[model samples]
Structure formats: C-alpha cells, structure tokens
Target: MSTQQSNRVTAVYRTTTLLAYQGNPLIEALPPLNSFIEDLSALRGSLKCTPEEIHLNGVERAHSICRVIDDFFQPLSQHIQLHERISLMIRGGYVGRNPDTGDWARHIQNGYERVLSGDLKAIKFTEVNSTAQSMTLIGCSGNGKTTAMKQLLSLYPQVIYHPNMNLEQVVYLKIDCSHDGSLKEICQNFFRAMDRALETSNYEKQYSMRKRLSIETLLAAMAQVANAHALGVLIIDEIQHLSRSRSGGSEKMLNFFVTLVNTIGLPVILVGTPRARKIFEADMRSARRGSGLGALFWDPMDEGREWKALTDKLWSLQWLQKRDEVLSGEIRALWYDLSQGVLDIVVKLFVLCQLRAIATKVERITPKLMKQVYEDELRPVHPMLAALRSDDPEEIIKFSDLKLSDTDKRLLELQQRVALSTQQTPEEFAYQQLRTDEERRVYMALKDDFNSKLLAPIIRQIFDQNPSLTWIRLLPLVHEYLNNPELSKPKDNPKKPKSTGRKASVKQTEWHTLDSDDLRFIYSQTDSNSEIYPAISKSGLVLNIQSLLEEAS
Candidate 1:
C-alpha cells in the first residue's frame, strides 16, 4: 500500500458480528463480512464499452481494448473462496492480541526484550496460544494467483490510523521475496513494506539501513514492528524464488515462517509457483504449517462450465466493428486450444486478437485470425503452451516460472506497434518476419529511406547469394540495390535449371505450389495477413538483383 492507496479508503470504524472479532479496534476497523452475493459484487473487475465505440478511429478503439488488461476481472468461485479464507485469516490473527486488553502490548514488549537480550528464541511474555495460522497458494504461472490476492486485499483498508491509541494498525502488508531468499533480507523487506504502508521511515531507517546488525537482531526488530502496528496478515509472493543455497537451505526459511504464525501471532500467506511445494515438503512439520488453512494448488482450467462461463463474460466486452453478440463455438474452441485455459493468456490473447482485427481492417475475430495472432504474436509462451499441450509431467516440472524469453518479448512489442500505428510502415509489418538480429539490423538501417517492401527482398537476395557474407559486407550491397532497382532483376545462372513454362505461369495465389525460391511462393506461406514483406525476407529468395548490384557497387 502507498499513500495514494491509503487515500482511497476512509477510516470508517465499524462493529463486528463474530465474538472473536469484537472489541478489538484492529478487527473493528475492518468492513463487516458480507454475504456471498455482496462479496461477488465487490470482487468483479468488469469493464464498460459500447458497440458504438467500435466506429471510432483505429487508435482510439485500440486504446479502449487495452483497458481489458487492467479492468476485466471476472470473479470465479475460487476467487470468492480465497477472499473468504483471507478474511478469516486476518480477523483470526487479531483475535488473540486485542490492543484494549494489553495482550498486544505484552507481545510487543516481549519482542523488544528478546532483542535487547540478543536471544530471539527466549520466551519473555506469558504464552497465550495464538489463533494465527499460515496458508500457501501454489499454482502455475499466469493462473491469476497474484492478481486475485491483490483484488481481495483491496477490500480492507491497508492502514487504519487510530488517533486515541496513537497507533497505525496495518491491516495487511504484502512484499515480494528477494531472489536470494535470505531471511535477513526478508526482515529488511518487512520494514520497507511497513514504511510504504504507514508512510513512515522510522522502522526501515532504524532497522533496515543498519549495516552491522545480526540476523537474529533483525528478526526480533521486525517482529516488534509487526506486533507494534498490529499488522494483520503478511503476504509473501514469489516464494518459489527462495534459493536454498543463499537462505541457509529451505528448512531455516520454513522455520522462520512457522515462528511468525505460531509464536508471533502473525498470519502468513505464501504464494508461489509449484516449485515452492518442494520447499514446504522438505519436512512434515513445515508441510503442516503450510496447510494450516489448507493449501491451494491451482492447476490450469479445463474446458468445463467454469471455462465457458469466464469466456462468455469476457466475450461480451469486445470493441470490434463487427461484434458477434454471442461467441461462436468454433472461435471459442480455437481460443481454448491457443490459451489452454491459462487465465492471463486467455485475456491477453483476446486483447491482442482484437487489436489485430482492428489493425488489419478484418474488424471481426475469426478462428483463422485468432490462430494467426497466437502463432505470430505469442511466440514467447510457446514452450509453456507446448508443455501444457503435451500433458507430460516431466516437461511441465521443468518450468517453475514460465516467463518469456528475451527475443519473444521483442516480437510481442512489434505486434503492438503494428496494431496501434494508423500510418503503419512496411518495416513495422516486416520486422516480425526477420528471424535473426543481423537480418533485422540490415532491414532497419535501410527502412527509413527505402520501402521495407523493396529493401527486405534485396537484403534476402544478397544473403542468399553470399551466405558467408557478414552484415558489415551485406550493408553496402543493400545500399547499391536501393539506388538501382533494375539491378535486382532475375538473370540466368549455371547453378539452376530453367523454369518450365507451366511453372513460370503459375497463378500468384496458387504459387505456393512453386519452388521454395519463388517470392510468390514465400508470400503465400506467412501467418500474418498484412503484407508479403516478412515472407519475402523469411524465404532466402531474391532475383539477380544482388549479383548485378554486388558487381556495380
């Protein structure tokens, strides 16, 4: 939570229905628990758009469609259940440590005394069995674990300031686990999260910025701040990033989480990819701690009622010119095949396909268009989708975090550029065609003055003629062809047989049946419907233009 988030929530104090949650200002400050219907109403991330909006200019419609990324959450049953569980966790954690009863003050004093004595494990306060419990959510990447949690946490005011008690009750604090997974770093992050949640620098400045502090001292200090503020529930995301080598092995980190729940009375929620499951399974005690509230393992959705329900809701938010009032079964089936029921991919694929529809003037999503968008625009997640498609356990296990590779990231950006540009250049459409950085570098250099339509083929001509030529040597030959277009004309070569009359006269659309070297054949093979520039460069085809230009330059 930042200052901006805190401003959105008014500190309206309210009474509670449950006995355990009553009288504690920490629990009382929270909104009352509502019926399932109310929870569903509060959790939806719906977007608003009209059929008339599709008549706007391409760029405007594209900008409107992009809103789906931030504002198109449809609350599923799992989301509502998660919300209810977290609600219980927060209120349950506060039950044993009501501030008015001095139980909370005693916990804070005990933590300080432990720090002062330099013995974090010492028992300085009267033991009151904690109602605090910990839970874990393990799932595949992009299954909406983090997004769902953020939306659920938003239902509570993060920081509630009680002027009379002069305390800032942090309703919840969420932090990312460091890549190193060091518990000391986690404690430092705790202080940093507290600073952001309360808009104060005291804890972070005093504890986190200190250089000579021992890990035990940091833990004691961190526990004190959490107790002092009555911090409700602590969510640690990316728990899969925890490295055993750096964090003194998985057992130490698990023990620390256990201590937070069992001793410090702070409920903990660990969210991570499936890789984190092995960390918790290191020992039974750790596994028990992880399942205090029953751990949730979210597999990718199957093509069932839940999938159809979500897709139907998402289908209604289209900004396409030729909007289909109902989703056709063929397109729906194709969508599932492409996305494989991963929530993030499902939404993003829809968004990208609509952008493609508007950009190409197709103005409607077809099974063919959706498939092309997935193939051309979504190369980054090919491996992940392949693993899911295989249904093989070993292949799926290899991907803990199915993040995009660097090259595929560039491809996605190119797609967005092509989709949004009203005056889209040939290079924007052709760039995705160039497979290698070397090919793209040459195309980009000459694309400013020469048409990519003309430049890409000539570059391919040079590369095909001189396969061993470096981009350095390739640049000059491309420059010569840009100046003299006729130099690229086909000429007889001793290496090739003459084309048959039938082969030479093949119709353009049916030219894919011709030799692989034919430009018409290459153009017929592309996944994108935009232009033939990409396909021309993709096949190493060119006329005698490179040979004549090479000699002239």
Candidate 2:
C-alpha cells in the first residue's frame, strides 16, 4: 500500500482500537551495557584554568574560585546508573521499524486492533510488541539530581532529523511540574517545551491558549504530538509539586503518567525530592508502570571514600596564597561535620571560607577559620547543616526548606565585581604602567618569556632610547634585547663573521634539517636574512623547529 493510504488506515484503526500499539523491540538499537558505561564514564566537565590564569590578586582569586562552581561536576556511581537508564529509555523509545523500508505501521495497526477487540487468543505469535521504559530519581534537597540529569542529557542532541524517514525526532524534553500540580498546566508546559525545541509556536498557540480544553483532551493532544515527533523521553522535574492536595489529587496524576507511557510509548523520567515518595506510594501499580528501570534514591554523600574523593578533588581548586597541600585531619573532620557531606553545602562552605580567609588576610584555611566563617558567613544554612548533623529526618527536611538567598546574593555581587575588574586592560591597572601602544605590544609579546615587573622596565628603557622608533622597527630590537640584554646597551666591539673559506658550500641534505636561527645566520651571511625571516615566521616554521633540529642533532 502507498504511504498515504497506510497512514489513513492506521489512523482509522487507532480510533477503533482500545489497546495502544506497541512498537518493535528496541533492544537492537541499544548498545551493550558495558559500552554505555564506557560512554558515560568518558563524560567529564571542569573549568579550564591554568596556574597563570589563577595568579590573580586576593579579590580576583576569590571571584575566580566562585566561578569554578559554574562548571564543577564530579561524577559518581549514581551518575553512571542515571546515564545508562536514560540512554536505554531514549534508545528504546525511538525504536520503531524503519519507516522507509518496512510496513511497520500495518503490523502495529493489526496488533492494536486485535488486542482491543478482546481477542488476544487470536493474535499471532509473530507480532512484535514493545513499551517505553521509565526511571525515577528521588533525592533530598541539593543532592545534585537535577544537575546530574541536565549534564547527562546535554550529551544528546535535542532534535534529530532522519531524511530517509522524513522524521524529526525529539531526543528529550524536560518540563518543570507546575507549582499548582494541575495536569492542565503540565500539558501546557509540554506544549511550550515542544515549541521551544521545534522552534514552532503552533502547539502552544493552538492548544495551550484554549482555556476551555479539558485535561483528557490536552493529554490526548500531547500524546499525538509526542508520537508525531517521535519523542524519545519526557523528563518531569520538581515532580514533588504534584501533591495530592495541590495537583487534582494523586490518583488522577498517576493515571496520567500511565497513559503517557502506555499510549504514547514515550519514556518518562520523574525527578523530585523525598516528598515525591508519597505520590509513588499512593499508587503502586502506576508507580511500577512508570519506573521500569527502577528508582535511584540519592542521599547526601557519606563520610566514606566517595565523600573523601569529592572533597579532595574540590580542595585542590582553592586559590589561597598559602596552598593547603595536605588536607589536615582537623580540617577534614571539621569540613564533614560542618557541611554534613552534602555536595552543595560543602562547596558553598569552601567558597565562603576562602573569601573570609582573604578578607581577614589570614592567607590560609584552617579549622578555626572555617568555624568562624560558618558562624558568620553561613548563618542562613546553619540550621539545615545542624539538622543534617543531628540525623533527624523531619528536622532536616524542615530546615532544608530554607534557601541560601543571602549567601548567593553576596557571591553574585562578588562575581560581578570580579568580572568587571578583570575586563579592564593591564595598562588600566594601577600597579602596571605602559606609556605607549608600542610598549604594551612589545611587553605582551615577551611577557611569557620574562616576568611582567622585570619586562616593564626593559620595555620603558628601549622606548626611552629610541623615542621616534615605530612598533614594527622596535619589535626586532626588542627581540634582540631579549636574546641578550647587553645588546640593548651600547656595544663597543660588535663581532663580525670571519669568512672561513671565501664561503661555506651549501648542502641540500643539511639545509632541509637546519634550525631557523641557523638558517637565519646562513641567510644573513648570504644577505637574505630579512627576506627569509618574516616568511619563515609567518609560515610558523621558525618558532618550534629549533627543538626538533636539536633532538635530531
């Protein structure tokens, strides 16, 4: 049958069928677990900063350290499992028979119709059936579940286009559950996310704006859109918002999730705090249907190997004047006690302590200093940290409800000031003075070779001697001075080359392997140095060739 005719038949069958169509098994599309683990293990992110980059003064160092939080992600075992589960869900959800080469739609329609007619006994054994998989991520506040999910999802493209199949596949869509927990609002969020992903406002414009639309109609429309776009996975963040009292009660919301999985064949991942446990417990069958890949409960890092590893890695990123090479027993114990092994609290505590250390000019981190900072700078989170230390679940939840607005605001202000300060040119700073563009350029070129303090005086001396020299003419002179400081001063007896034998014979074999400095010396003897040096340097053959020649020789 033609593609157009097949789609029409399938649509008609879908309307009459009671049972949803399950696509072909997705096992073939999924990589082996080992391969998946390897791919996930290879994922890493860190702020790119060298020692030179971190050589900022006190205030600059504090701000730079704060900025590291933006990219700091330490992978753990939960991260590996999260990657594997999500990868499977995405691969499985996208696995339908090839639209270009197979009559898969016909098979789906037949199976769906037969199952709907209550004639499962009559259905053939040859039919393929598969459903979407799901996983739940439950964690306490600031346990890094949300951050981990985002990092892993970032590895896949948001949209994939298959030209042969004429399909635009959405790899993943993350929607924040509405604070009110209404299914209608969740549907609208889905439409908005779709519009954002596809860069088309059609869905939101058409369906989301229709206030009269019922939850069932909205869900049906969402499923249709999901299938049409071949959505791989749907992530609902802040799922704890779907409380029974807030989101039309638990039963309705639970059924909605079931429908999403069974009807649309779209994998759904629910990420929320411990409060979400009540929702799952309210409906065990619905929870089972939603979580095919099992749930990951992320708690605070224990004071074990993982905690030590994380703290040790983060400890190395300190920008203090006095490097804490060895994490002292007192400091380590105090750190775990103060932060309670919570990743977010641990990092913030570290940052705040660094700032305090700098402001006080103590120039080093210590147990006593950390305690003082905790009491002074981290007052907002003290209760939560205390509750965690107490090991009281109810008290912990209650205290954790507090947000670090004051601390975060201070950090942001510091970051902004640092950003503005760093934006100024080296000449703008009070400590360094460059009187002219020529001086600045020459200093910059040789800054890597010599200390800025040492190089500045030399640059000033060269410019003072030749006030009329252009930058281009001054560059060669600067290079000469760098090669020999005595060349900058007056040379009474400049050595001239002695013609050993009228001239040395040029050998083709030796010429090819000669260093640029040697080549320049030979070219100058032959009166071609000026012509050759610029071309050789511009072509990048002169800069790094000396090491190779030295090694070969």
Candidate 3:
C-alpha cells in the first residue's frame, strides 16, 4: 500500500476501532520492520527498570543505543520550525507510542481515555481541549515532578514519524524560577529566555539587535519576538522563588504569564516547589483561567525493591568497563550503595571511580575501591546532605537558596556515599566480623592504640614481602592496610596547579588487587624513587589526552 493510502486506512481504524488499534497497530503494513519497531519499544517500556535494575540485568548499552536513535530522528532535525504546520488532525493521523512506557504510558498533553498520568491520574481531557493548553507542573523538589515535566516536554518514543514542519514553528522559552527574584528580573529573564530560544533555533544573528537592547520598552516587545519564532511552551522552572522574598513578585509575574499566554494564545509550563501551591491557591482563579495547573512533586525515590532495580541498571553502563572489560556484580553493588540511587550522585560517583580506575589502571571496579572514592572524592558531599537532613525547614530553605561552597559540596557527596552505602556493609565492619590473626592485629591497633598510621606500614610491609599474591589472597593484607592510615591511605583525586610552587603529591595506598594486571597498571602510574608511585612519562605519553580530558570534564 502507498504511504498515503496506508495512513488513511490506519486513521479510520484509529478513530472507529480505537481499542482494537491501540496496543496493536491500526494496520500491520509490513512484517519485518513493523515487528522490529514493536519489539524495540516493548523492550524499552518493560526495561523502564531503574539504572540499578538495568545494571543487574546488564542492559545499559541497549538503552543508550535506543536513546540515540530516537533523538536524531525528525523531531531533532526540524525542532525549531515545527509550529508552522499546526492544524487540525485530519484523516489518518499518526499517534506515536512511547517505547519505554508503551501505549498506556505514552506522553500526551491532552489526556485521553486510553492515555493516563503515572500516579497523578486525575483527568483525561479531550484532544480538542488541548490545541495549545497552558500547563502547570507542581511538585516538591526530588519527588521527580520536575524531572517528569522536563521529560514530557519531549516526544514519546523519542521520535515522531514523518514530521511535517513549516518554516515557522515554535521557540521554547525557559525561565529559571530560582533566579533573581523581582518584576524587573522577570522581564530580564524573558529577554534571556528569548535569546536562549534563538540560540536553540540557530537564529542568533537575526535576533542580535533585540539581544543587545536593554531599554525598558524592550519588555513589552517580547511579544514580537515570540511571534517571530512561533513561540511554543514557555517553561518557568522553580516558580516558588517568587514567594522566597520579593515584593509583589508573584502578582507581577502572574500578570506577565497571563499577558504572554492569554494575550498571545501560547502555551506555558509552570514548574515549582510544593510551596508554590500556596501561590497558585492564592491566585487560583487567575491560574485556572490562565493555565490549567498540573502539579508534579519531586522527592527522593521511595526505598524498596525499586532501589535494587535502579542500582542494577547503572552497574552495566559502558563506561564501567575495566580496560574495556565489563563491570562485575560485586563492583556494581558497591557503586550503588555509595551513590544511594540518586542519578546525579551515581553518575559523579562512577565518573570519579572511572577516572581513578583509569589513573590506577585497576582492571575492575571493586567495593574497596569505591570506599577509597568515598574517602577521596565523595568525602566533600557530607555537608550538603547534612543540610538536607537538617530538622530546620528554615535552614533548608536558606541552604537551598545558597550555592554550596567547595568544602561543603565535597562533604555533601561524602554524606551521600554514606547514605547509599548503608545498603552494603562497610569494609571495616566486615573485617571486624571476621576474626583471624591479621584481623585481630589491625583491630587492636585501631581500637586499643589508635595507631592506624603505624599499622598501615606494617600491612604495607606484608604486601611488599609477598608482592605476587592475588587480590583474593591479599584480602588479609588489604584489611590491615586499610585500617592503617600511615602505610595505606585513601588516594586523592587529581587537582589543579597550586600557586605555592609545591611539588604534586600523589598519595599512595596499599590497595587490594584480585589480579596481576590490576596491580601492574596501578604501579605503572607511580614513581620508582624507592617509593612505588605513579610516574608521569609526560614527554613520551600523550599530553593532549589530558587537554581532551579537561575539556570533556
């Protein structure tokens, strides 16, 4: 069948036999391509397992590949100009489904009988009511309300098939809610929002004159800019900032939102903290008429089997490969506990671990290494977590308003590691559990004398004596050295140049290695100045590699 003919048949089936067509196609036009597309989406949806669960099943590569294919399709190439084609959905309209969530979970601004919201299933308004409806995304931080809103901004199944775009489409504008709080600041933000949309649309030069203007009249001129780019959704993130302490900020901003949407007939997306509900409630009348508010609250994920599942998904990311070797289960679980299933924390934890693994030339990710990361890299995370755990809502509010200092940020990461690691037994605790001659000696030094430094050297001496022992065999030695701070301590993450003209100090740790390659790569980085340490063969090795690493970092 011709593409046009097939679409007509499918559209008729979709409208008349919606159920029969749903979950299944209106028409299975072909077998091979059709089934490949079908099965791929099924895997994606069921595979909605968290990073941890996916890691346990070893499926990160599959997920990434699917994402890449979806992103590059028509939605991307024609993003800036899709609004011009806006018209009524005629015969044979294509309704795409989310591969990850399948038909039931497919994204739709106008919820329908078959489509529903996750956990927030309140209403399913018709498509006719949705032509360009304004939406309000409400929720608390970390509850995933904001993240879901951002994710929903994109198309379901990632790609929209055979998208037809006119020369004039949408310009998406985002105004950060937590930014400078004032009526003037709001206008400035609108200007910046326009510039950002221009940048995204690759229409920078054409809008340069508007970008340079700082005149007061420029505020009212934002409408022209929106019309120029065919503005789409104007997302205002962190809307609760208005209530944070700006005089009449809410009223003025709400009025501006009203002007932008009601005056121009454009859709706006409002994202804010749970506290934002107070603002919306105060002006519920205006908000209702302005944009139907949909609250999305974000909080730390619930603790449950999903925790394990999320942890497993992260374990198998391609970056976890040791010398390009796949990551093992023991290492994966260690990473999970240290990261506590937080996406941001998990990614950083892994990156820190990977950089260390590369520098050390460790052949694999091990629980002990993750502990080293906790001490060296993640130690900084403690203070932020302290703030989060603080009982004072006022302090949380204050702290949330402030950016983290270098030391405080690092401490917060440490706290996250501690929280996540609660899922796994610490090395010290496990060692204490096992009683042997070596364990007893290390324990007594730490508990009785607190001679950790003295004990570490002794443990190091043992490893030096039997250097050929495998990591499994060297477990006793590792236990002793880990306890002995003097001989074996946590390694520091590489840092910037110091002004004092001090020589770079690379702290060496007597670590447990399960294999020979692991030990060799580690020792290779160290200097052989009677001290086994990583050596810099700067002249022979690639210096440009460090530049690339710096750029990427």
lDDT by residue (tens digit), candidate 3, 296-370: 333443445655554445444433233334445546566555554444455556545544443343534555566
lDDT of 2 by residue, 246-272 (tens): 557778787778666654456899898
Residue 6, model 2: lDDT of 12
Tens digit of per-residue lDDT, candidate 1, span 332-386: 8989999989888898889888877766655667666788888887888888889
Which parts of model 3 have CA positions greater than 4 angstroms off? 1-132, 138-167, 175-178, 181-220, 227-230, 238-248, 273-291, 318-340, 379-381, 387-511, 516-553
Q: For model 2, give the 10-residue run with minimal summed lDDT.
A: 1-10
Q: In order, what lDDT does every prediction score?
A: 0.76, 0.65, 0.41
Model 3 earns a TM-score of 0.45
Ranking by lDDT: 1, 2, 3
Clashing pairs in 1: 488-545
List, in order, the clash count of every candidate structure. Answer: 1, 0, 52
